[model samples]
Target: MPVRKLLLGVLTLCYPVAIYFGLQHWSPRVMALALVALALLRALTSRQAGWRLLAVAAAVLAAIVAASNHALPLKLYPVLVNAAMLGLFGWSLRHPPSLVERLARLREPDLPPSGVAYTRRVTQAWCVFFVCNGTVAALTAVLASDRIWALYNGGIAYGLIGAMFAGEWLVRQRVMARGRHG
Candidate 1:
């Protein structure tokens, strides 16, 4: 990956933890300003429309945080991320060439029709996952304490995502092996 994207990805992954500790040391306005700066950095580095929109959303959220001086706005970044993922994956389902298929094609460029269908189903699964994850993220952001929010958004959420990826890898291995035999 490009350094900019890698850096942004790392920063994004660290966001919840940053918010958790930042709250103890920084004012909400400062936190909000940091979010706005991150958003601007993302916008500058990425040209994809979805990413640009995400940047705008982040900026809006930052504005809210700045105005309200509240931690909840800071906490909603994960929810926003999930919503964006859901939108991307769900839209690909309605359109042709599902996102997972596009990605799978990077390695299996000549993927068979069954592989195509399988990727579509995987994309659908991701949409479902995004919806459920986003819902939980929203709930944690609003109804839970900061520690709970941080724990879920920062740690537990990534663990669940890792589980999904590992499960998918196992299933994909079976499918690929079966394709060779059958």
Candidate 2:
């Protein structure tokens, strides 16, 4: 639970760097084997449904990379992750009380009507961000150099997410202030 909650995101982001350096020292098949071991270990340690789904996806990707003897499949992990997040957030929109709303409720259980609307909009915005980010990731994986892929996926991507978090927090504060004053 601790690893899944705290460390999983960092580990996931490191995938690009791992593959980039791994190919320098090992064969694609060997790298694929390592990925499978990591996935299996994570699966065994975590009971989260989301992690289980990701484990299956990772195993399939590993199998493809092993058989194909290529890094393309390995590089698609970010795209796959974004797709999964989009699915989760989009599904929540249809089911009501969106993903962001659920997170909001964790801190403010009795969110006002305005807060609910804001969270829904925020979830939709995240869906858009996931789509755009995944598309760029896929393009880089297919067309860009391994170094570029690692740079963007491991570095720029996290920076963009941090920017989004900061931007949203600023916007939320302004929204709350407006609600209080108006």
Candidate 3:
């Protein structure tokens, strides 16, 4: 499991540059095949049934399209993923125990009212971030060059996410400290 996590981390870090150059140097068909294989392996190994099923279905659909010799726009992958994340987070907002609250509960099962409010706000922030990220991804796919698309999707997006995570942690720490004192 550690090895898998390490590999995924490395792959994610390298994905943008790799895909950008990959599209330039290799045929789309080859890239599509490789991506499908990786997706299938991930799906087969996934612990969640829903994710496994979704991944399998997506892989099968991509495979069928590949077999038919249609060039699956490589740019669409990240766009679709961002859009899905937006939907997931947005959907969670409408349901009780929003996504951030669930994650917060994992750390503090008996979360305070203040903590619950904080998590809900954080969840809403994340939902907004997803929507903007997905919009950028879609625009890049439609209007930008391949290199530009890859750079934004790969490097810029990850950088923004890391910054957001760090910012949230800092805020949460301050909130918790204030709550304890009060």
Candidate 4:
């Protein structure tokens, strides 16, 4: 990957961890401004219009809320990220190619008919996962303590996503093998 892309990917991956630990001393306004700057810079550089625009808007909203009430934005960051992901996935489902289908096309341009169906189903699964995960994060923010919220959204959430990716890869391998044999 290009250095810029790699840096962005690393930053995105480390977001929850940074938020979880940084909240102890950093003001949410500062973090939110940083996020807004990054998001706007990314949007300016992005070739795609859809997600980059949404990300910019979300970041601006985060900054606005953070400026007014630091605690609120800190609590809502995970929820907003997951909710945005859910929206992106759900919206893709309504269009010609779901997100998974588009991604599958990247690797398997002429994916089999069954593979197409599998990708669609996988996309749906991800949509559901995001919805449920976002709900849990929201609840944790509202009903539980900050530490509990951080633990769930920052640590448990990533673990669940990793497990999901591993499980999906295993299943996809089995299915593709079966298709080859049958």
Candidate 5:
């Protein structure tokens, strides 16, 4: 019931739903608008700077969708979305009590500094992964003139998410092994 878990669950469900409706040729503009509205609501309720930035990015994405309706450029939408997500990620990273800090707090009080450092590194790596994947997805959509949902939700989305999950597991395993040894 934690906020992080709630966000993760919402994202997990929303991604597939977005992909499904998008592939069906639903109005991307509407989708973008809805997201923007939600982001705006969040921003209004929370005083956090990160949430405000997210709201702005969401609004920008809505504008991109509206623009794309007039002229279907290959790289336009994807590039815009990727840049927005990257900017949001960067903003979140800059703020305090980031993902790394949250994860570290979950650990035992007596846990070594190395473990905390490892967790921070892993979280940072995950942020980088999001940036790289977003860039690739955006570029592919823009240059290929293919449907963004189809391309991103197909092999690319699965592969990237799977790889990140596996990488996280591997890091956790190594951390545990080191803990056992020490």
Candidate 6:
């Protein structure tokens, strides 16, 4: 499977897990420990050693925060993780068009017919997952009478998801236009 497809699948799974963890109000220790485990797994499997190392470092920091049980660190960790995710998505968006051309070059004539279709399906699934999860979070926040933190965190998650959707749309538009005009 292509890296893009794999990433989309992972993100789809992560989105729901994040929402579940948030809704459960999982203790910082539990959340941090889980994320650390995830990071370690990602690091071990990732092709990029540098990013893998960074993930390891993030895991360590999360472990420390969990151990300390500090409110400030707990509050900051979510924001930091969200920022990192946003940055990764943005970087993917900013890649040069030539990269796609290179992918086209690399394609084998005998490649399976399902490859492209499968990628599209995965990408679309991810879009739906983000939209639904984000909407649910936002609505729960708005409807709840108490828990200001829930409302605030939900709002942020919704905004980030919206941003990602908008970015994806822009990329699709650009790609379509290039296909038509090129």
Candidate 5's C-alpha runs over 4 A off are 2-32, 41-47, 67-98, 146-149, 153-155
Per-residue accuracy of model 5 over 63-113 as CA lDDT, tens digit each: 776777522321233344455555654555677444655656777656577
Residue 145 lDDT (model 3): 85
Candidate 3 lDDT tens digits, 20-49: 788777776667765576567667566866
lDDT of 2 by residue, 1-182 (tens): 47564565566667789888998898888889867876786687677788788888989999999889998888888898899889999999999989999999999999999999999999999999999999999999999998999899989988988998899999999999999999
- Give the top-scoring candidate (TM-score): 1
lDDT: which is higher, 1 or 5? Answer: 1
Q: How many Å off is the CA of 47 in candidate 2?
A: 2.3
RMSD to truth, every model: 1.0, 1.5, 2.4, 2.2, 4.6, 9.3
Q: Is candidate 5 or candidate 6 better by TM-score?
A: 5
Model 2, residue 11: distance off in Å is 2.2
Q: Can you give the lDDT of residue 115 in candidate 4?
A: 83
Clashing pairs in 4: none
Q: Which tens-of-lDDT digit does each residue in 1-182 have in candidate 1?
A: 89988998888888888888899899888988778888998899998999999999999999998888988888898999999999999999999799999999999899899999999999999999999999999999999988899999999999999999999999999998998999
Give the per-residue lDDT of model 4 (tens digit) for 1-182: 67887887677666666766776777777667656765776676678776586566668667675768556565676787788788888998999588999999999899888888999999999998998999998899888877888788778999999998999999999998999898
By the TM-score metric, which is better: model 2 or model 4?
A: 2
lDDT of each: 0.92, 0.88, 0.75, 0.79, 0.59, 0.51
Candidate that beats the other on lDDT, 2 or 4, i.e. the better one:
2
Give the winner by lDDT: 1
TM-score of each: 0.96, 0.94, 0.85, 0.84, 0.64, 0.43
Q: lDDT of model 4 at residue 5?
A: 77
lDDT of 6 by residue, 61-155 (tens): 67786778643343333444444544443443355322222343375444343434433443444545444554444444345332443444545
